[model samples]
Target: MRPVLIAGGGLAGHACALRLIEAGFEVELFELRPFFGGRACSYRLPGYGGSEIDNGQHVLLACCTALLDFYRRLGVEHWIRFHDSYYFLEPGGRLSELRPRKWAGPAALMAGFLALPIFDFRDKWAIVRGLAAVRRQAGDHRLDALSMEQWLERHAQPPRAVERFWRLILLSAANEELDRLSAYHGVRLIWLAFYGAPGAYRLGIPQVPLGSFFAEALWNRYGRLRRHVGQPVDKVLINGGRFHGFEVDRRVVEGSAGVLAVPYHRLAGLVPQLEADFSEWSCSPITNVHLWFDRPVTELPFAALLGRTIQWFFAERGGSYLKVVISASRQWRTWNREQIIQHTLEELKEYLPAVGSTTVAQAHVVKELCATFSPMPNLEARRPGPVTAIPGLFLGGDWTATGWVATMEGAVRSGYQAAEAVIRWLRADRGG
Candidate 1:
């Protein structure tokens, strides 16, 4: 049996390897990094009672079926705890909760609107109308051309409501602001969160470190597969329009097929044939300031922030560890660690007045300059599929055309799809 080569050991690559191994194929995975989990990896923080902290806080939704399925398959479904209600905290000390009701169908939908504390009568009407518009244009392609802000403005959405409420919702979900995000993507997010299930707005956070939940679980499942770490592939070796293998550390590693699962910017140099248009697929930065407080600030697991410097905050179990995720944090990316910590601490104090005079036990800053691709207009065109022009080569990354932004679920889905493509190609070649 010819071994299938997988380039890059991120979520996509690992997922593909697991699937291929299950399908009766030997696999060899090459990863540049010494560890896995890609941008979603975890690190130990000195504070937080010596608990592990993620690079940034990532929340999964009920609609994340692929990721949930992956967790279940890996036998780590219990590592995630789901919340039936989500709280949106405004800086002015106002809180809104989106809770699920037992009512079925549209009744449940109406219940969510009525239960939300952010919307008034007019705002509720506007949301209903916006949802109607979304359902009406489900099949239209023009939604991709307009930004979410433009779409809402055209519908006479109030500036205050859009800025204070709608923008926050979109930013948290899409990881991009409405002014720049595509209306289609924004609408898709709303559709999935609202219409998917009775309590679709429910949120889920990992109970354990992200690395333990994902990478370790995957390794345990496919630990015996040929694995190489700290060895980055320089380029994909092509001979006569066929992918022969790859060059790692100036040494050639030959294989029958390969999956390039590295990030976008690194792809062009590795595979010159890959015509990835990064212009449309711009990256959005995510900054997470992990703070350990002597006492808990809020009992709520996670809360959204509005009218405050802090965009979102989550309280972990070990201690009052609050993670502030500033999406599209391009400006703050280059700030020195101290400066970043100072600014974030100031913002945190403003949100939780009780922590105003309290001394910080510990603090750390984690920033991902290219955390995920901004889902802007025309981004759909920039993302390609798993199967590339090369006969024995494939692409698998969240940035691919997975219809999902740079997410764990998207990465896993891309890997699953790529593995299926490789399996189909192998079976065809054998005339099976």
Candidate 2:
């Protein structure tokens, strides 16, 4: 049997390759960039002593089972540090901690929400009602037709609760405003992270750079697997309504089966024959501002900022360095680097008083204009599955129908699904 060809070395592609190799199939992976991780990657900044930093602050919740399984497969589970408590900072340095009470079991999240001082009794009451609605409306297809904002309004969520609570959490997770996000995705996120399982809401931060997750040395044990970095797949060759091969660097690389794991935006140019309609598809942006200070600013490892342009900040290098993330940052797309840096610093000082005294030694900004697809109402119906009309061809990406928003976990799930499809196809072909 020929090697299974996988295109685009992102999480989806790598996950598919690993799964195929484990299933006793030879696999070949091709990537455009020299590195493996696509959006979730780290690079050495040119200035300020070549410090390595992720393009953005990417964290995972314990509800991300597929991503955790991937980490365990690579023997790097220990590199992730999970925090049970979430620190939310208001203006004037008012701090509120949301930590689950283990003794409370399934009701721990509810207890923590009720104890928070940031929201008044009215706000909390509205939120409690909203959560109850979410639990009751599980698996409701009508939610796919409504936006999260509309759902929240229907549930009578007050302005304060919407702004400080729902907007803050959903925007960061979905990378889109509530008005543009599908209520289906929003409700599923809340249910999985907070209400589904015990200890599922804990936040996990990577101790090492994201690129280290797919280091070349890690694939040494997979003898049948081959990697082709810095090579782009120009076209997908099809004959007799079946995937034949891929054209790369003016040469054809044939495989018994193939997986196209690239982003939706790049799908058209590679294989226009599929002719999937993506006219309604749009993107959302995320901006990250990295600031290095002469002195430490805050003791907390990370905090969610309330009533500010900067939504969250992750402390690095003993708190002297910080990465501030602004999700759904369409407004900031026009602002220059200087403007973003200045605004972030100003907001930081309001939450962390020490930021006012500290001098910023260096600052860098990263803007991902197409960070993720906007999870609009009815978009889930448009997301394609692994199987395609073409035989021996499969699709894998976070944008596919993974029943989750675009995240690392969704990406991995798509890959596994594609691999399973490929395995079934091969077995059926061999009369197994």
Candidate 3:
């Protein structure tokens, strides 16, 4: 069998190649970048003690089964450390924790939420009622039409409660403001991970850099799989609207099938028959601020900052190194690097007061302008599916209609879904 050519080396493409090989198809994967992992990958900064840093922190939830399975397949499951507790710090340096109680079900979560000093009796009861409403309406189809903010407003959530609690959780998960996010996703997140399963809300942080999972040697473990980095597929060759192969580096590369696993923004140009229109699709930004101090600042592994532009921070190397993250960070697009660092330092002082006394050793800022497609209201229905007008060409990416937002789990699921489509098409083509 001729190898199935795959375009894009991101999670979707990588996952498709692996699944195709397992389905008895020879696979050839092309990545324009010199390495794998795409937006989830890590890169190093020259000088600055020769330290390697992730492009951005990509954490997973316990409920992300597909992503966990992908990591297990690569023998990197142990690299993830899952924690059940979430620490939130107030602007005045007060701390709050969210975790399961001794009992199970909503009662367990309610206990934790009630214990938080930030929320009053009214806020707590409003939230409990709000979550009960979410559980009841999670399966409703019309929720997709409304923004999360609208849903919360209709549910009578308090202004302070929405801003401090609901907005923080949903914003990080959907990578968009509550006002712009779909209520379906917001409710699904709360119900699936919190209401449905007790342990599903556990946060999983990779113990190592994300690039380690994309090592060339890992792909070699699959004998039928081949990888080509720095190789860009210029176009998917088609004759009379029939799928053929891909054109790479000005040369035709023959294949039995092809999977277009690139970003949503890059799909239409490479495979015109797909007729993918991303006019409604827009990009989201995530900014990371890394600060290294001469001495330790905080021992906490990670924490969410309240009432600040820096949403979350992760500590490493005895807390000397800290990575601050801001999702949906369009506000920082215009700020220069110096301004970003200065503002971040000011914000850090509130949570980690020691940062004021410690001398800064180094600092770096990375802003991913197109990190993920924003999950705005009405955007879910606009996403394309795996199959296309071209029989042997399949679409696979986080942007696809995988019933998931633009996430690693969604990307992996789309790859698997596209690979299934290709296998079924080829079998029918051969009259199998």
Candidate 4:
């Protein structure tokens, strides 16, 4: 059997390639770059103690089963540490904790909300009502038509709760503001993470760098797996609405079927025949400031900062080095590197007083301009699935309709769905 070709070596591409090989299909994966993981990658930096730091700090929840499965396959599941509690800090150093009770249920989960001092009784009631609404109307199609902001307003959520709780979480996870994001996409994230499984909401942080998950040695084990790195495919060869091959360095590489797992921006240029309007799709940016301090900032693993540009910060390597993440950071794009570092320190001083007295360490800032696809209203209808208009051409990416918000789990799910589509098609062709 001719090895099936998969374009792009990112999460979606990697997932699709691996699934096909496991199902007894010869797979040839092509990555334009030297490494995999795409936006979720790490690189060595001079200022960062000359160590490999991730392009941005990406987090996962225990609810991300598909991503967890992918990690288990690589024997890197042990590398991720899941935190049961969430810490919140205000500008004046007031700390709050959110954790489930000894017993597991909705009430146990709501115990965290009861402990928060930021919200009033009315605000908490409104939040509870909104959450109940989400759990009740999870798969309602009308949710896709309304923005999360509009939905929250209809639920009579207080302005403070809407801003600090709903908007903050939604903006970070969905990579779009509540006003711009679909209610379905935003609420789905909250429901699945907090209310789904018992330990679903536990924050899973990779103990090692992101690139370490996809070690090159793992590829050698699968004889059916052949990865081509630093080899960019020119275009997908589609003749008469059917995938024929791929054009690589002016050479035609043939395959039985193909999975176009490239970014959403590259979709139109590769195959113009499928003329769908991609104008609704836009990119969101995320900023990560890697700061090393003379002393430890906080003993807590991580904390969310309220009413600040820096939404969250995670302590790494014994709490000396910290990675501050600002999601959907369109405003920060205009700021220079120096401005970012300075502002981050100022904010940290308010949350962690130890940071105010510390000095004499270099910093690094990583700004991913186009990190993920913005989950705009009605985007689910626009997101094409695994089966494209062309025969034997499967589309796979976080951007594709995986009923997810451009997350790692979404990427892996899209790949698995693509592989299933191809397997069904091949079986139909063989009359198996």
Candidate 5:
């Protein structure tokens, strides 16, 4: 049989290719860039003297089963380092750590949350109640119409509690402000990350560059997959509402099946028949300010900063290099490189005292304008499924209806779902 064509070399495309090959189908994956991993990729800066850095820091929780399974398939599971504790730093360098107690079972997280000094008695009470409400009312369809902020207010969540606890976590998770995020996603995130399993909330950071996870040699293990990097699909060719093949470099590349695994913004151009309204679909930005100091700054591996523009920072190279992350960073959209760096340093000095005396040897700022699609209220209903109107053609992307926000896990789930749809379609066509 001709190979199944997969467009986009992101997690979704990679996942689809692997699954199709496992199901006894030849797969051909095309990527526009010379490298793979899509947004979750790494590249060396032109004048950085061969120092490789990710486009953005991509972290996963233990609840990301699909993404982990994908890593296991590539034999790179060991490349990720899981952290048990989450450090939170206040403006004056006050430290608060949240880590589950050994053998405490499901109550471990709750116990840890209660022990945090960041939340006062009233704040803790409000958060505990809010979590209980999330457990009871997570999947209710009515929650989709209301914003997470409104839901929090209706539940009598204190302003301090909302700002210090809920907003910090959900904004980074959903990549949007509470007022713009849907309560359905917010509540679901709480359950998935906190209640899915005992170790569900443990953070996993990649020990190696993100691009290394999808190296060509690793993918070559699957003989059925034919990877075509730096090759962009020009168009999706369909005949009488049936998938034909993809047009690349002004030539038709025929395939048994095709999966449009690109971003939502690029979907209409590929398959115009879908006629989906993308006008309402919007994206959120994330900013990463890389600061390399002359000496080690913070001893901690990673920490979440409170009451500041910088949300989180991950220390690398023995704390000499810090990757400061600003999720939902629409505020910095207008700031220049110098402005971002100066402001990040000012904030870092307050949290990490060592930054006040250290000199920044180098600094680089990366602003991902379209880091993720905003999970706004009522937007979930518009997300498409794997099956499309055209036969032998499927859609695979994190923006699709994967029951999760635009995370690595959602991307892999979409790919697996699309591959499953193709398996059923081709099997029925052959009467197998």
Candidate 6:
């Protein structure tokens, strides 16, 4: 049997390799970078006291089934801790918690909705009506052209409440604000989060560095697969309208099946035929400011900040690590490191008063200019499926048509789907 070549060694590639290997197929993974994990990768901070920091802060919701399953399969489920509820820290240092009550059916949803402190009484009722509207909408076309902001406004949603409560929730889930996000994506995200599990609002964070977690867990499971790093695929050579193979510098590797799991922007150049539609697919930026404090500022696992420079902060076990994630941060990317750090730290002090006098041991800012594909209106039309027009060639990135924004779960799901498609094709070929 010909070996299946998986390109771009990010989450999707890694996942594809794992699944294909399990299906008794020879797998060769090609990664352009010296390291793995792609956007989710981590490295030691240069001047920030040598602490390991991720490219950006990533949080998993309880509704992330695929991500949780991936962790369990990789045998690193213990490395992550889940918070039962969400805590929002206002700029004025006020704290608000959203916890779900243990009631059955619609009662639980109602209880959870009522428990949220951010929204007013009218806003709470509006949420119920909005969800009903989402449930009533049957076809995808109805949601395609509309933005979440427009949908809420049409439904008479309070702007202040939407900004403070609804927008925060949407920002973290969709990676874009309601005004720019698709109504379908926003509604789907909220529905999944609220209606999925009993503790659906739970948040999970990594206990160790992301690299170590992946290395010890995922790499260990697929120990036999020959992994090559620092070998970025420069070009994919297609012949007879089929996937012939790829070229990495002077070396050439051939495979019957391949999965392209790199970022969307990188895809067009890798395969020029994709250039036309690729440019139409825009991306959103995510910025994280990692600050090391002398002591713990807050006992909470993670806190959402409103009406401040900081959006969210998380306290890691290593230290009081404050992470400020600015989603749709296109403009923030232009700011210098010092300016970004100073602004984030000042906001941190406003929320956690203890950080006012305490000296910051270290500070670092990390940015992912193209952190995620923009989930704006009409994004559904732009997103492509795993299977392309080329035979034995598949695409598996968060940017693919996963109905999920650029997320770990989405990446893993795409990988799994691509691998399954490859497996079926290979099996049919052999049988023939």
lDDT of 3 by residue, 61-160 (tens): 9888888898898888999999878898987678778876857565676677678878888898899899889778987768989999899989999987
**Clashes in each model (backbone N, CA, C under 3 Å)?**
0, 0, 0, 0, 0, 1
lDDT of 5 by residue, 361-408 (tens): 999999999989999999999999999988999999999999999999
What is the lDDT ranking, best to worst?
5, 2, 3, 4, 1, 6
- lDDT per residue for candidate 4 within 1-432, as digits (tens), equals 677899989899988988898899999988888888787888777655578999988899899999999889867789999988889899999998987774647556666766689889988888889888888878776799999999998999999889778987787788888888899888788888667877787889998888876678776788998988888878889776678989988999988899989899988887777786898789999999998888777898999989988899999867888999998999999999999999999989999989988883869899999999988888888899999888888899999999999889999999999999988987886788
Minimum summed lDDT over a 10-residue window in model 4 is located at 102-111
In model 3, pairs of residues that clash are none
How would you encode candidate 6's per-residue C-alpha lDDT over 1-432 as one tens digit per residue?
567888887888888888888878888888888788898888886666677888887789878888888778777788788876778887778898776676556446557657777678888888777767766663455686899899888888787668776787888777787888888888777777766666766788887777775574457566447677898888887988888888878778898787888888787777886553765567788888887788887888788888864678777754476677787777787899999988887778888888888788888788878888888888787788888888888899898888787899999999998999898877786783
Model 3 poorest 10 in a row by lDDT: 102-111
Candidate 3 local accuracy as lDDT? 0.87
Q: Write the per-residue lDDT of candidate 1 for residues 1-432, one digit (tens) a residue.
A: 668899888778878987898888889888887866788788665545667878889888878888888778777888889987767776655677766666656446557656687768787777777777766665355788999999898878776668665687788887887888888888887777767665666688887787785454356557447888788999999999988899999998887788998888888899878676575457888888888777777777887777755688888854377887888887787799999888887776666676777677888888888888888887777688999999889989998889887888899899999999999988887788
Runs in model 4 deviating more than 4 A are none
Instruction: Please provide TM-scores, in order, for all candidate models, with all chains considered together.
Output: 0.94, 0.99, 0.98, 0.97, 0.98, 0.94
Candidate 1 C-alpha error for residue 329, in Å: 1.7
Predicted candidate 2 versus true structure: per-residue lDDT over 1-432, tens digit per residue = 999999989899988988999999999999999778899988888867989888888999998999999889989999899999999999899999998777888878877877899999999999889888988886787899999999998999999999987888899999999999999988888888668779898999999999888787888778999998899999999988889989999999999999999999888898898898999999999999999999899899999999988999999889999999999899999999999999999889999999999899999999999999899999999999999888998999999989988899999999999999999998998898
**Reference-based lDDT, each prediction:** 0.80, 0.91, 0.87, 0.86, 0.92, 0.79
RMSD of each: 2.1, 0.9, 1.2, 1.3, 1.0, 2.0
- The C-alpha stretches of model 2 lying farther than 4 A from their native spots are none
**Superior candidate under lDDT, 3 versus 5:** 5
